[model samples]
Target: MASQQTVFMNHGQGETSYARNSSIQNADQERMKPMIEAAIAELCTANNGLSRGNIVIADLGCSSGPNALTLVSFAVEAIHKHYLELQQPPPELCVLLNDLPDNDFNTVVKNLTTLRRSDEPVVVTGVTPGSFYERLFTAESLHLACSSNSLHWLSKAPEDLTRNQIPAYDIDEHARRERLPLVVEAYANQFKKDFTLFLKLRAKESVPGGKIVVSLLGRRSEGISSKFPRLVEILLQILSVTASEGVFEKKKLNSFYVPVYEPSDEELREIIQEEGSFWINEMCVHGLTSGMDSALITPNRLANQMRAVFEPLVAQHLGDVMDEFVRTAEQRWSLEGSLQDEVARLATVAVSLTKA
Candidate 1:
């Protein structure tokens, strides 16, 4: 099958910029490192002299430049530490950075240039590149694949919940629920296809029993019922109210939510099992607290962060009215009684899967 491809707004905040500049600094990497190291250690133990040769790693959805660099550096350090324990020479490393074509390729190139300046002999390849859901690299060419905080985006908006089918702004519970299945189906289908392709590609490219570590936003429910956590529901409420006020256009709102399918751990496990190329080695759910506590912090800061994350979608649909929409949304939240609880740190779930 020809690899499917689509283009969306760049969301210019590159991976590195988003990670470094966000309120949550290294929070993602810190949570993921131990899991990654353990997986690598296990892989080395299974295969004698696996750490002795060139080791190839790929970071899927390696947004912008700095984000990829951060992951590559972490992987390299981890591998080197393992080599020390094994009393073997450090493996030559090849790190492939992959992302959508519209991503900040220039920034990634620049950041990697600086890394090359170091004395260490690192072969960094920039695969400027393609979607992770589609084929982006050769078969059986990778030792490990790592993707963080990016899988939530499906290749396209779900077909059933497209702009035309979405209910009017004042949609009630029944109508929302009725539409919810289609929305979930769209996300689920696309994710299944994309992830299946990812697993197949990884299996062909990676050596036997290579490791794949992915950290993404996950929820504990498969349906759109009240089963979702309170915090996510609150965020949805804020989004709905703002969207109804025409701050975010109806189409953008639908597109934005279409791919936000956070599967429960059991649901995720089932998906992996069906794919048949990976084994669920380890998994954990870590709350992604944004750390915006402190009573002195202003509402504007919170608003700005929300805007930064969603502005691309808003601008795409709302045209010139995007800023006005955001302002009105902020006003609504303020009137609803300052979002004190909403200010608490958000949580994210991470999982590590290995080749079967």
Candidate 2:
């Protein structure tokens, strides 16, 4: 394992941008509509119609592009519908979009302004730029906080890995087949600390009895993927082969690792229990095949999707070898036999919680 500079998704709306490659995340967000609606309904009812007050909703990790405001749209509508049913005037809304400082907030802000002008004229939109792992809002001011396809990202790579130490064993296969704390101790420990801080910070900002809905990639079973396909394994394989061929210095490959973790149900439950700020109103895991799905998945499209997500960190790591790296990725991914057959079994986990 190695350290990560921690970059956001590909910025522009090109063929290889997150705006185009995020269909998988968009699908999961749609699947979560019922859960989100229920949460908002419960929240509105609990607040006794919330007549004439402002409801504060925050979308954590609301990265740029088409998927940025998906949660916000769903939440605003749900809040309105519930109040309408109660025959009371709907409350004013404060919709805050949050992500890392490097996120493409310019695009997000433009889209938000367009959305409000075209339809949601009364909604107020603001950007909160910082790591979601830290305090980004006022205490006890949030009514609901929703995050999608995020939370699996650690604020920073573990210190042990950042010191440029690479384990001798195969970490990818280790993550899928079995979790050896001996090998993954640093990664596992980092997730525990990051997630705990996330919850603690949110708990301070969220009002008592507020709702939280989070959807993230998870390790569904011992052999299951963490959400989308395990592209990291393929990437590492590419780097290793190139390094062996003297394409780049082996040390470069040794000094690069993507910082991502996929936790199990047991791990999540235990953390929530230990944190003790919220109740698990609901927790469910679903296997999805939506990424590069519906139509047959092509190697070209798959390469582009991976690029949208990983290119920033990968390009930075490879430096002068970036062009060769991209070419090899496309060619090698094409040779991944039966990927079209296996594109339908990704895993995602969703949990809805209430502040205690």
Candidate 3:
């Protein structure tokens, strides 16, 4: 098994730029609201009532800030909508915002405090810092578990591969290609472990027939072939140019590959079945077009949004190399006419699961 340290290094921290963007909050609410509402409605109907007991919801990998609260509000509204139809007293609601210990807990608290003004009582609890791969909640306690754009990250690093292999080299195509598989393998193994743990934990924590909604970035299987996708290839090329200009260490360029695997609908269904304890109710793949609502629907805008989420992290790790990489990427995108289209197309998948 890869050590948890590696996973932390690659995936644990939140992107500072993303954390600061109100646009992301707006986009997330718009994207997830209807889906979450529908899932809660189904869960309530299946269980026969919304007033049976306290309703508990957990947002796993919830970064600190208003975004988590936005999710909570959506869940609360869904519950209330169901309650209104039944003419029942609103159920006591418990919202748990969970993330890594290093996350901005203060931000989460500040956001939750603002959300407490609703007429319906909402008990907000912050899970004292922890990894979702391990135990984070008591068994049979959570009614719904929601994780968006978070599960693709591995829970730990691929130590075994790293121990056996030499340091990855960008110029060595064969070595780079070989190392990618190992990295992917390690990420897959950790994803399996975390996902399996998630199902098992939810089984114990969730009431019978409770539901979980997960929305994540995913790619088609064809995207992961021996040759890198155009998007990834472009990123590498930019990194190479930046490195030559002495903006970043040559080795830092090697770390630019996307870490999370984007499973196809079929692949995800298979994994859900194999992992057990949950049944997939709905799955849909859609383009991530919401981020472009106000911006010119060009590829540069799309790339900029991607950079908004990545540049800060790279800067933190690679410093001057980060600036050069961004500049080079922008130049390449401009030259390639990458943003010719009015809309930037990205693939995303959302799935609803129920306790088995």
Candidate 4:
């Protein structure tokens, strides 16, 4: 309902910075590699637009940090790899890194110098800053556009949720997920409207036969959220404690809304069909289920991970309680049972589309 409200990952570097806490995104991109490669191969063979001498590919929601350019590198390498398989020279690459205007573009730009590559490919880059739901590029100016782990963030929280018309968070010091039936309907409708508008705008910007690959966190079942432990509920639980301690106003906790919605694969397909701008090439709802097993899971690490994502948004309402909040979160998450369930399952929806 609201338009163009910004949500951002923690921009700079630190334990709580998105750059450090974003390892899971690397896994998401790795799972998406096959879909990306296939799309590039099809773009090379099926579309004659590759002859234009320069290929323009956009990595939407390219948040800053080490993983920022990972997708961009994937597109570039995939195109060149396809050309190499055919023993042909790949065209020049024009890379666009897109994110919210508030995103840490500086970190991404700084990391560009460290990438290993040769000059034969001649990669030129630019930064596109704006909401992807709006027209961020010229008409028919792109060959491929991809987004990862970002679409779940709506253009804004539902106006009803923000205004406390829908009872997502309660007057008491707790999040009301059981009372989320109306909350689910409101969020679903908002995501449908935003995602449909996204398709239409990209259709106007992309070539007639361009490709779009998108992967974001989604529900496995046909519901608003996953059956597994919800990390959001954990965050709300901590926030409510802060409110009860008189750190923030009770009404603030009641009114603050998370501007994100994880749609099911069915809901995604429905929106794509109804929009009618792109043909679904490949679609799936399976991703890393093993979750964060890389290292010993610690409460500090887990809280920092969630804090990197939520600090900016949470700070808007809670003010200077962020450090104290993170401290409190760490204290709560220190128990053995706190995070083993939350980090056990990570599901994502990946779709490859061709402009019709």
lDDT of 2 by residue, 1-356 (tens): 34448669988787777888887788789877888899898887785324447788999999889899999899988877787787776677889999988898888998987435454326788999998988999988898899998888777766775674644224355543453344366777888999999999999998878888998877565664233224455667766766666777776665666776767767788899999999998888866444335564565665566677777887787765545665766676565565554444446778999998
Cα RMSDs, all models: 4.6, 3.7, 4.2, 2.9
Locate the minimum summed-lDDT window of 10 residues in model 1: 1-10
Candidate 3, residues 245-339, lDDT tens digits: the string is 77766776554434355555566677789988888888877655564464544434445545644454445545645445656666766754455
**Taking the candidates one at a time, how many backbone clashes does each contain?**
12, 0, 7, 0
> What C-alpha lDDT do the candidate models reach, one value each?
0.61, 0.75, 0.62, 0.78
| Cα lDDT tens digits for candidate 1, 1-356 | 00122333334554313433434324575678887788777766677226456777888877653456666667777877887888876667777888888766776776766545264455566664887766676666677788877776666555544545553222466766665555555567766676667677777777777888887766654343533333334445666666676665544543333244455566667778888888888887665543334543445544554554444544444445535544654675575445555544345667887777
RMSD of 2: 3.7
For residue 107, what is the lDDT in candidate 2? Answer: 86
- TM-scores, each model vs. reference: 0.79, 0.86, 0.82, 0.89
Full-model lDDT, candidate 3: 0.62
| Deviation (Å) of 217 in candidate 3 | 1.5
The TM-score that candidate 4 achieves is 0.89
Candidate 3 backbone collisions, by pair = 7-157, 140-204, 140-205, 141-205, 247-321, 248-321, 299-339
Instruction: Give the per-residue Cα lDDT of candidate 2 at 16.
Output: 71
Candidate 4: tens digits of C-alpha lDDT, residues 96-187: 88998899999988887653356577788888999999999999889899999889888887776666655456665235655566677777
Rate residue 138 of model 2 by lDDT: 97
Off by over 4 Å in 3: 1-16, 22-29, 48-52, 125-128, 166-169, 178-183, 221-237, 252-259, 290-304, 311-317, 340-345
